[model samples]
Target: MEFFTEYGEASQYQIEEIIGRGSFGVVAAAVDTQTGERVAIKKIHDMFEHASDGTRILWEIKLLRLLRHPNIVEIKHILLPPARREFRDIYVVFELMESDLQKVMQVNENLTAGHHRYFLYQLLHALKYIHAANVFHRDLKPSNILVNSNCKLKICDFGLARASRDDPPLAIFWTDYVATRWYRAPELCGSFFFKYTPAIDIWSIGCIFAEVLTRKPLFPGTNVKHQLDLITDVLGTPSHETLSQIRNEKARRYLTGMKRKHPIPFPSMFCNADPQAVRLLERLLAFDPKDRPTAEERL
Candidate 1:
């Protein structure tokens, strides 16, 4: 493929095969010739095509450099371009993993309850460290979580992540680049609030937890409205008190006007889930962000 052939600058590594492809870039599994360590090299093509895209790439590089932890993906190296002032594609080398959580779940049906517990534990551990650093991974999903045969988990893709120290208003509209709709928190679905907190990530983890247990997306909505409907179908409608806290007038009016819904009992929804896990899921998916437990508290 073109990706394998256009790596003259990365001659230190032998590209094995293309592992993944997406809008951000192409990822290839390889082995470092000098160190003999297996790695994944991501080639981001036309990285400077858009100013915003370039800025996000810079932020991802900075965050990965600054936030070093066992549960977070480590960037081993970034191959320099031939020209300093002008470069279209950038290559980043990272620790190679067997697969991501999304693919693991698809092919492996024998994942036990213990596996789920450990996965959640590791994810919470990572979140605690990230939140402690004042950063929040806004786009969290099974695909963003890398895994190994030993079940080691690491969070990746920080392009959408932002620090909460100088918290900014989240985008109201759902976009291809933003958090995937199936995993997005309710507040993010309609721009329910002005300031978003780490709790938003908590909600995403809860959704992922459910998917880990069931091997299917908990809420596979066709659109924004359908996404909210699916969420309410399980969690029920938000209480007036919670609705009162919503800063967006239109969102509040929509929730108030919608038909009242009582929560679907967790036991019934996830028949095979452990009661203790169900309780934790409840707290993580609380309608009000304030009610959701922090990563530190959960760990």
Candidate 2:
């Protein structure tokens, strides 16, 4: 396993320590020698080892270059090693954040209602910008949201994002396994052939919001079938029209055969939650994608 000791010949940045690591790559904390600014550098491993992985990495870079919003992580620099064609690692530098939403929610016991509302507001503000750019994040979860002690939030990790056009080419199809299971939208879990839309991100936002309030995953399922069951248990089974929208025959039949379930009232689900917050959550988590409110509408 190789690790970076320093970045650039002039020692422009000094690697302090690794901040996080996941299947995608490793993120490290570093200080810019020129300006004495802290930055988080993500070293994407094996980017050029596979064509598909390289394409996704390139797509993420493209989207990040196009997205410019306070609520979205800013790319400070892109570093490529010599022999670019054969270079296996891709380094992307971003402004360092105090922590991610997941870690903040875990350790902060005295979080107020105001904290939750502000985080959600920033997320929606970022989503509105991304959606306006005709791009779907496809992956939105607590861990993907960065935060600061000041309560500012920025959305990150666009590796799974997809561009959405008014009429996307026929060859373009969204991958079914995009978002993490806990934050996945009903449409993604209910059918593999479901048409991808920005609504999926709204549903994920609803899940994240619920977690922020309760400090637990809204729907923690072990498998696809179990995931669908969890969703139905809360929002109730989809109507015949909603079921009909599922393009995957197997998934549609499986849903149709399930026993009917009455929807759980949002207020009851989110005990003591403000009525307006509950209402917004319900709209965001609507079973039908068309029924889900747009990010701008939620704001």
Candidate 3:
């Protein structure tokens, strides 16, 4: 497939085929003619059309350059625009990967316990590195996790990621839809908490692991309220102290008015999963963010 638009730098790479497409743009697998190495070129079309999209692109590029790790996808190059023409589109080159975890989970069912352990290990290791740098990948989902056939994994898409601050309010100064709803933490379900921490990412990792084990989304909520309901259904109602942490008076009242829920045993919910794995999952999915383990601790 041909690129939607041409770039002078793209002439050096032999476009093999279109690999993927998303709301932002199209990704094409290509080979560097000079080095014979493969790469994935993402052409974000009309980047400036939406201010938020443009800002996200710049933020992602800046973060990728700052945070370098084996488990993080690397940006090889950014194709320069023409000298005189107004810049509208951008092409970014990244290391090629066979597929993302989302596709793998959908098509492959033979994943063993070893595979699950290794995947979780790599994810935690990557998160530990990012957290150490005071960076939080607000969006951590299967689609953002790229994997190779050799069992290698790398985290991608830092568009929604944010750098942590000493001030909790500034650190959590983000919109309610910070992450994909399926993997979002309860604290973010309806702005229940006044602040958020790296534990949000840990909760996301737990949700991802649950999907890896069951080959399905753990909390596939249809709406915000439904999402919280799905979470409470599995983990039960939050404790009074935890509920007290809710800064949103309306949200707190909503929960207080609801029928109390009893926690479902993870082993009962994930019957085929290993007991040891379920034990770890329970701690990861704790209602209170503080109760969750840090990526470094888990690693």
Candidate 4:
């Protein structure tokens, strides 16, 4: 029978209201009594009775405790008191943001070239930080991005994540479960992505970049086949001639095996943006994840 105060003092942490709800938790706006600061508290469903999912939720604390960055959601404390919901006893404290990108996108004024640059730059900074920590977001969608009161964006979500630095890329770590369907890379939906390099993260980044530009998903694929189809539809199918240089048959399989189609860029979504940004999207959304741009090159 644990209590909130015994756990820590979020009483000073006034949870105002719910701002966001996810698969396993709800995020609310909170204010700190000690520092007179604003924050967000993510209350993960506590299912102490159910060990597997519960343990995984608890692991969020371990991962959050290890990471620190301006772009990634900042963690302040872990609520260790009485279990809540299905989670045994889990409450992860975070800095409250004014809202998430999803809600922000609803506003008309923020949808333009200028805001796009700022949004993308911030996302890059967050991804750079996660990669430096050797952690892959696995999920990188606009919905997962949140905006602080000052309009700074941060990346969130670590579930469905795996650490590859400790293991060689032997087999798929449940491919179907990796990342969101739309933002998922070619290899993720079909083949292996370069023995598990952080490059896959960049692939996800490319997808995200494409989405932000058009205000629509780069590859809004419903499944494995559709995923490839959506990509080829935009970038056009890769000719064996273009990929004849690829030695590994498995590596070539992604584009070759799938039915290629003509690419249709969605310029209608954006009014006035740099052609360079468009060019960059084409490169990032390549059929082959290997052909995707490096973070340095992107910058």
Top candidate when judged by lDDT against the true structure: 3
Worst 10 residues of 3 by lDDT: 1-10
TM-score of each: 0.94, 0.94, 0.97, 0.81
Where does model 4 exceed 4 Å of error?
1-10, 49-52, 82-87, 169-175, 191-194, 239-271
Worst ten in a row by lDDT for model 1: 167-176
User: Cα miss at 119, model 4 (Å)?
Assistant: 1.5
lDDT of 1 at 37: 98
Better of 3 and 4 by TM-score: 3
Judged by whole-model lDDT over C-alpha atoms, candidate 1 comes out at: 0.88
Residue lDDT tens for model 3, 50-159: 99999899999999999999999999989887653658889899999999999999999999989999999999999999999989899999999999998899999999
Query: What are the RMSDs of all candidates, in order?
Result: 2.4, 2.0, 1.4, 4.1
lDDT of 4: 0.67
Worst ten-residue run, lDDT, model 2? 1-10
The residue-by-residue lDDT of candidate 2 on 16-105, one tens digit each, is 989899877889899999889999988888877788778887987898998999999999988757564657777888999989999998
Clash count for candidate 3 is: 0
lDDT of 2: 0.85
Q: Give the number of colliding residue pairs in candidate 2.
A: 0
The TM-score between candidate 3 and the true structure equals 0.97
Give lDDT tens digits, candidate 1, residues 209-277. 999989999999999889988989998999989898888787788888989999999988888988889
lDDT of each: 0.88, 0.85, 0.91, 0.67
Which candidate achieves the best TM-score against the true structure?
3
Q: Over 4 Å off in model 3, which ranges?
A: 1-6, 167-169
